[model samples]
Target: MTGGVPEGPGDDRWGSDGGWDDGSLDATARVVDADSSEEERRIEAALRPRRLTDFPGQQRVRDQLGLVLEAARRRQAPPDHVLLSGPPGLGKTTLAMIIAAELEQPIRITSGPAIQHAGDLAAVLSSMSEGEVLFLDEIHRMSRPAEEMLYLAMEDFRVDVIVGKGPGATAIPLELPPFTVVGATTRSGLLPAPLRDRFGFTGHLDFYSTEDLVKILTRNATLLEIEADPAGVEQIASRSRGTPRIANRLLRRVRDWAQVHGRHVVDLPAAEAALDLFDVDARGLDRLDRAVLEALCQRFGGGPVGLSTLAVAVGEEPDTVETVAEPFLVREGFMVRTPRGRAASPLAWQHLGLTPPQGSPGAGAGSQDTLPLSGDVGRFSG
Candidate 1:
């Protein structure tokens, strides 16, 4: 699959009208710095798979989505509204763009936060042309009223436009053009039942495998004109937390390091040196991740600690710590979330090169001598 659109090297042209410059595409594409250069954004846009065949991983979703788009094309009708739910950076937005491209329809991108009121959503819905793709990202965050409006729009293709004050309000039924709504959310369970039911198709994206990520990274390296070895690509893929965005980001960082060190290619040593310079370990844990583990173990004695307290210990936001850090830590068995609070696991202690204290929940020791809270620190060699 050609990553949805066809473009060659130095082809920085980003679709008709430069879709990214309008500020709609940046919300999902900018994974690194908020102040990312325009060139960086262009490179990311160029990397996107324009068609379904080109998308990597998610075989089930790819096949199902292809069938949906193909059937819709055969009928000459708009495809059903698609709901894509998963953790961030797993290619929900990319799939949305591919849906539009496959249907040869234009896409209007926006987020739930952008639509504060029912009227806000109504305006966007009213303006869309027939068969357009309306991509509403973070749909769970939308206001209830707007969500209710969306329900009516999705089911009946009509919205009751209120024109005046409460008692004197005039209700006008407005007919909308046939359009496909592709909604993406990290927290699918948070969506109201009626809203969730409106979607005809739902796809849940999972983490990419190392082989899949290697394919993605290799494609990206070629697109970026970076000379990267297979080993270097594998090393980055293994440490990418199964995320394509992170793999691409690591590749860029490795490229930058190699350029700075007068190296012409991204070899194993270049990749390792660059990753070490950036503070990412072999197991893909970054500085913040290590800090959270360290705090939960040493500072809290491996006891159940509150998420907010842990975030405070690291001087980060509770949401950031929970959403960005806790998921992977919990998934990798480094931490556990109980009804009481968050707690470090035995693996966390082992990874940090420290022995778990006796009688602690994660220590797995029964009536043994208490180990020192400060054990010998060792460099992570994952």
Candidate 2:
């Protein structure tokens, strides 16, 4: 554990170790972050599954990836460029490393944000040895020029290095070693068709089921040498927001609680206490998430409020509201986005212990009698 960041089999490219920071109040146990301490990162890296077969969830992606890697192994060549698309914390980066491990190749890690210029990408690509795996995280956010350069590199294993000033610039073709490029992104739609099309396989990761999360937390407990009961593990898994990273994080917090309380084993009470201390509810809604839901239902009267309005009301960046809070909320059926704005669902009203006001956005067809849908008015379906 070098400076809290473990050097592991796939440390080459800074693939996503769930890529979240343990900063702010959310650090108590928030899983939807992009910054974290080196120690925490190392711990996460250490916990990652090095082999695809060892991976916990996303069975479809796991099996498909297995075939792709196996085929390449038989051919003794690098596998096709792979694109991993999913929300944060679903193990895109871990899968990238597993690809390199299965292929028995060195991997060079980098992110779209890191490669601001074409030169940045060219440098990394050109330095790669034969059959190296280039794991690029957040590949959708790469700069246009860098992305253009990557197109050629991914397709032909070559890059155009421009030398000299603008008018005198000479395009020298740089042939890179035949390498496999594995790209991970939270937003695949943002990628241009040309870039997306270059990928030979695209794997979309979805949320882990409670059973899968339980398996992940149980494995983590054994690895961390923490004594935890099945009830404790299940309780933690249920409130982990359907994320393995969150489940592991909650397990660590529960371990701390157990140690402090003089309990050798983590029990359901300890799990509940730890989660309560961290301000995560039974449904995995954090303070920030609750704040958004409350603001929408209570302040905006079930909302049709714009994202900026909602963000300002909740004291968070619009991006955070959109990216971090909204996706989960939307996925969990607590909120809906319409052409006009975001609105709370009836479930959101119920979760907050309030009845949906008659004629309100969430009040349903019964309220439609009083508040008919207007052609010009935005409607939220599903």
Candidate 3:
């Protein structure tokens, strides 16, 4: 027996830390990286509509983008560098890919975080061929150095490479190949003003309408070969938070339910059952969402609660609760943002199975007490 833990005869040549013993560490690293890359590729590919025609929703954006791309192609020039801003899962990435496809150009994808230094961006830009689309996702997060380099690259098609250190350094103006840059960001507000002004075109993506989401769900269901009732599709669409990604995900879950329950097609019942299992309520509020409403109703008496206070009550980041959960609630008339803070609408109280408190200050007055707050209602009444 060996003095230390025996490594077995064949394992003696390798180090004790499992380095090279079986190449496990290397294999593990490669596997993890490969899996991550594969996932990214899958997302990029799945959400990428093969052509503008396959893209189901955002009709206005589609029409406007079609014109821009066509004009660029007719003129035989690279399309204008575009900026897309929107909430996540609203098809910003898809539109970027569509722009490249429509322009018949190769798109080199990178993110703000990937360009750690000016040199990093210079390397990527310098390597590009003519007419390439450089997609910088989350461009707002890019380092200051990289962003400064981008200003010159976007405006002049050139970069000044500084060589050597300190006193010995000299900037060599290097001409770059002409390319279009498409930047996508969830927070366009965070992008520096100078950088913001550099893009030739900016597209603001908004949440899809229930009708658009219905169309998206039906199209995806047809493609996936799942038989879904129109009513089922509509139900799923209404609950999807006006996002195609969420709509598609809901459709798939309902399809799974149909399959497991031996139903030949997904009907309204199946859709309801699936959504119930997923904890998406009739108004599409999930558990976390319900918790927020419940807190506002029961704890704060339907609340003029601040966002930070609400987030603390729900145990979530204020931003996440605001951006992700609150939008749907607001859209559905379950909540309203007040000058004071956030307050639950009458519908919100109803949804939470709670009676609207008597004489709640923000509750619209003179309407039948039973009536939920309507868009036309005044902010306050005597």
Candidate 4:
């Protein structure tokens, strides 16, 4: 808003290397897309950890959640309404399922967008059985009316059913059975204060470590009945963009390559070939990601270029470049968003194998070593 400049993932869909930050650019890697397709989602469901013990990463969240669930179980009552927030593909849905399983309760799956009104949310909440877990995904996207209704339901285990409209309307209080609400969101900040406070526990999921991703891939390979070498699995892990979903997807894709090429097992070569075919590089940078980087390093001479111009240089829409490619590029330290526009970082120059010219931005010129063409440059904390 200051002189038409963007700040804090507000107005521009990008935060100032703080909120909504972290290396998750989170979209169109396709292979590493945060969003999922129906088939991909189906496969992901089959591969998800059914219990907390089986969940590979987020050790802190897992342990904390285990204590909470165990305490609730000991008390012989439904646990508090839980909130899981993080970048997509970090197993929020899987954890929700695990919570239900731990409680030995049935889970009713629904999303925020699905409940458009107070009545809609009330209908879903009122019919729930005692000890049931209502898993609300994309919890931040719920309509305000539904969210308000949820506040009362979560606090009092009751909902008010309106009999009529306006002046003639009668509020009939409906008592809901003891139940738990497990809400998952990628954007927790969008949630209102009242809605957020209603949740007893909030677990923020982070990107998986490479070792954790490796363990996940190995387990998934066995589940898929794919013979995979350690080296091959490691290769996949290294390129998974620090996300388990991406690792598993890459493993399955590599399995397909092995099956097609008559290889009995997924080896390093098979993994490499499959990844190459998909245009996902060693760093899990797909064509679009790399294209953005290439356009910056090569076309724009390491940039100071506008987002729109960068998008056009790659024959893509600006939003695509902004949301899909640029976030990853900036987050990975390969690019930076500057006052002037976008600029490549020193890492980008190094990754592209191009020389950062003397006296130009991102060339590591002068005394300071880091070069991002901005006053503040680092991965997002979110």
Candidate 5:
């Protein structure tokens, strides 16, 4: 949903306002460099699948993405702007990198928060080589001015530079190299309608199925040289919140357990023991996840509690609670959202081995109180 009216003074033309002449570009560059440290760069490079055939799951997205890149190659032109939306760690960043790799183009990585000023976005856009992929992660968090700048840049391959302050400011249109913008967001809903429409193709990644996750785990285990049985991989995959990142993380933990315990390989029993010790259930619920449900059922009386209240109880930011903890809780039928707030579902109580209060907003609740909570945000558990 669109946020309320803009606050403060400035012409909200999509990037014509020279408001970003501030040092936002330098700050963004620094942050991007920090994120691309030696270790992070190594891990991302090692794990990033080089081709669509190597990328796992999201068949529809793969097909569409393949066609877009192929068509762009055939025409010898930059590909259409692409939008990748899904839960965090569901491979949006990976797909963006893959798009660049597939097109044999360089990629410049940045984020919405990094481009606090329109000037920051302009600096990056202008610096990109022709046919490069500008991977903008967390695109939803970009400032208004920067987003506006991005619109003009994407549409016309140009940006207007304001030469002076105040009424005497002159607009200088600077042509940029033809490039592809690959926008990735965990909160696609927060994007402005105009910004969202600028993309030629949008790829929505869904939670991988248990089978898909198992395949991913098996592949990663081989890559990491960790010995794991088929059943062991299946067990880990089933408990990975249908996320490849979670599966990878769990595999690492299980490997540590196996090594310490002197097991030659990860077996089903060993996997179970390792997960139990880590407090991750077969359904992927961890300690904090269960704690959230328990607190709602026991302390808040099956809650229609506000998000802030839940965050306070859990000692997390409201964004973290809403984005990381709530998605899977809702998807597993453990939570429900009402006009009042968030309430515990019957499944939540059942998972916690507690019964809901009589007449609580459970199974037979009326249609009006049931707001469809998004399952994408809660996958990571912060």
Candidate 6:
């Protein structure tokens, strides 16, 4: 919707209406990217739950956050600066919108990458009205100067505006109306301690349960006016990688497949067919996901290879692989990122129908079938 959005549906973002994209093939994005494309964002808006009560997952976060809002309302003031920390696509931005809606105030949207300087941040903070909500996505990525400026703005609701050159510069004191800053970040640990301390409430979102994802898919199916069988809906939900954004995004693609094939309703076969067309395997691992595993197990000899080396083996940039594919792989136990480098778990070997060599990391652990579907191999590093 702004400068970074693709003019059409074919930019860095993928899997929107009007075009069929094999999401994992893109250089810098995936179908399930946390940084989704504009068209996908448009579709997502229609599917988002407008209120906290209606939000489908993260029930604990919802309950705790509800109390914060209610208490703020009673005091007739904006709630404390709230920080929502989690992986992308876990509804941080959606929750930010819901907060403003519940408070009945206007909300301003921006990202950490967009604010380059202290002056830029000062301008945004200065333009606020009382009780308004400023939703900052990827708040951890803000520039050092902007981040320092944010510390004061969050605590004191004021900013020091500098005028003139280095030595001649003057700090102009400016008071701001009391407003709420709702910041979302995937990497909260990167935030400076002083800045992190300013947030009154910090909520960490986790993956949705299979039941939650199913409920989400079913609700959106009716909203999108798609007649889908329970089997089709369940199939899609199972392979959704436990993320709501992915569940809804896949629904559209399956719907498109149904329409083209002259099927009046989506069934299990239809779901499978659509996913196959998109190169999504039964476990929701796309081509890129499998590529990373293959490179680790086959090419790198179950490496301990560097991320850069693995990315090169797969013909992708390191960041693209790290951001777009590695998280899910690490989360789902297909790979591991040790200090040595990236390595395949035993599950990764079995998934590729190969045996882990003797003494390989996790090689003695047994077959991939013996592994849990969502094991914690280790945290994926940025």
Best by TM-score: 1
Model 4 steric clash pairs: 9-14, 9-15, 21-380, 22-380
lDDT of 2 by residue, 1-382 (tens): 2322224434443324432121101111223246777668667867888888899989999999999999999998888999999988888888988888888776666778877888888867766678878788889999999999999999988999999988989999999878898999999999999999999999999999999999998888898899989999999999988888788888988999999999979999999998999989989999999999999999989987889999999999998998899888988878877767888887888899887777788787433333323564445432
Q: Give the TM-score of candidate 1.
A: 0.88
For candidate 4, give the lDDT of residue 340. 72
Whichever of 5 and 6 has more TM-score, that candidate is 6
User: Candidate 6 lDDT, tens digit per residue, 183-262?
Assistant: 99999999999988999999999988888988998999998899999999999998888888788888999999999999
lDDT of 5: 0.78
Candidate with the larger TM-score of 1 and 3:
1
On lDDT, the leading prediction is 1
Error of 3 at 71 (Å): 1.3
What is candidate 3's CA lDDT for residue 367? 40
| Candidate that beats the other on lDDT, 2 or 4, i.e. the better one | 2
Every model's TM-score: 0.88, 0.87, 0.82, 0.84, 0.84, 0.85
Candidate 1 C-alpha lDDT tens digits along 1-382: 1222213233342334433322233223433346888887788788999889999999999999999999999999999999999998899988998998899877778788878899888867776678888899899999999999999999989899999998999999999878999999999999999999989999999999999999999998998999999999999999999999899989999999999999989999999999999999999999999999999889998757787788899999998998899899988978777655777777888899888777776677422223222232121111
Q: Write the per-residue lDDT of candidate 5 for residues 129-212, one digit (tens) a residue.
A: 678778888999999998898889999999998899999999999998788999999889999999999999999999999999
- Model 2: lDDT equals 0.81
For candidate 3, write residues 1-382 as lDDT tens digits.
2211123445553335432232221111111123446654453355447688888777777888888889999999887889999888898877877787788766666678767888878767766678877778889999999899999999999999999999999999999878899999999999999999998888888888899888777777776788989999999998888878778778878988999999968889999999999999777789888989988888888877788999999999998888888877887777777656777877777676677668663355424353434564435221
**Which ranges of candidate 4 are over 4 A from the true structure?**
1-42, 317-319, 365-382
Instruction: Tell me how far the alpha carbon of residue 198 in candidate 5 is from the true structure, in angstroms, after superposition.
Output: 0.9
lDDT-based ranking, best first?
1, 2, 6, 4, 5, 3
Candidate 1 wrong stretches, greater than 4 Å: 1-33, 365-382
